[model samples]
Target: MKVDPGTLDWKDAYKLLIGSVLPRPIAFVSTVDRDGHCNLAPFSFFTGICANPMMVCFAPMIRGTDGKKKDTLSNIEATKQFVINIVGEKIAAKMNDCAIEYPPEVDEFVQTGLTKIPCEFVKPPRVKECDVHLECTLHEIVTFGDHPGAGSLVIGRVVYLHVLDELFENGKINSEKLRPIGRMAGQTYTRAVSDTFELERKKQPGK
Candidate 1:
């Protein structure tokens, strides 16, 4: 069925957009207020953007009920820094708990019972439970549209990367060891297990 995006409600548009988007990598973001109260939240609309400068991007959508921004965005704007913690199946429940709508003064790190470790470069703390963490500085914040429901695209430049010993060997990261989890449509998720295939590009004849 054909539907006009302009006529559709935000929830309807979100449903269609997320369902068709398939598996999305999650960024369990961590940021702190000026007083040092840490906040943790997950965003499915996240991915790495560049290699030379090592940039990452995540879209923190407006709250469906109030059409207001989330705490993660507020903290980033105030502190100008945050950490991206890779989530795994083991930490999914805790991650979901942090997604709850609590008062701005409430500390998510304490509420979720997650250890908040100090970052070397950023003021925000990193999730000690997460296998891999990227400490980043705020690069830019872009608004999608005029509506309050419009997304805020937060771009960060990677400053420090913390990797657990077991998840890394040589120079590459082991997906199975990392066992990172990704968000799927609806209330589902997927784990990075087993082997991944690779295809080598072929040249037309030999030079």
Candidate 2:
């Protein structure tokens, strides 16, 4: 179907985007409020930006119900710190449990029965259940719009990383051991370790 995104409402556009995206890597982000209350949530609109500065980004769209920023975004804004916990099949359900729209004072770690480990360089804690964690310092937050469903892109620089030794093979991570989970349309998820394939990039002419 040929659809003009500009002609569609934000909700419809979002629906189309999510439905067609197939599967997206989820960023299970944890942040701390000014009072030290820890918040955890999952965002599918997340990706790595660059390797040199070790930057990553995620989009925290405005809450659909209230048209306001999410508690995660608020906490990141205040604390200037967040940890992107890699979601694996083992903790996928627990991560989903934290996705509920809890209040600012709510500690998702307690609510979801997840353990919070102290971060090395950030105020926010990391999920001990996660095999990999990227402790980040807030680099910037760029807002797209003021209306509902609008998103704020949060860019952060990785200050520290924690990875399970078993998940690392040689100089690269073992995807099969990691068994990462990804987001699908609606209440569905996909596993990265299942049905995998590889392709070598084409080489250019040597000088």
Model 2 bad stretches (over 4 Å): 205-207
Best by TM-score: 2
Question: TM-scores, in order shown?
Answer: 0.93, 0.96
Residue 146 in candidate 2, Cα distance off native in Å: 1.9
- Report the number of the highest-lDDT candidate: 2
Give model 2 RMSD, 1 decimal: 1.2
155 in model 2: Cα distance from truth in Å?
0.3
Q: Could you give candidate 1's per-residue lDDT for residues 1-207 as a string of tens digits?
A: 988876887778888889888689999999988888888999999999998799999999888767788889989999999999999878999998988999878888899899988889998889999999999999999988636557899999999999999988988888887888888888898776754677998888975
* Count of backbone collisions within predicted model 1: 0
RMSD of each: 1.8, 1.2
Q: For candidate 1, which ten residues in a row score worst on lDDT? A: 143-152
User: Compared to the true structure, candidate 2 yields what TM-score?
Assistant: 0.96
lDDT, candidate 1, equals 0.89
Kindly list the per-residue Cα lDDT of model 2 for residues 1-207, writing each as its tens digit: 899997899899999999998689999999988998889999999999998899999999999989889999999999899999999999988888898998899999999889988989998888999999999999999999978868999999999999999988787888888899888888989988788898998778793
In model 2, pairs of residues that clash are none
Model 2's alpha-carbon lDDT is 0.92
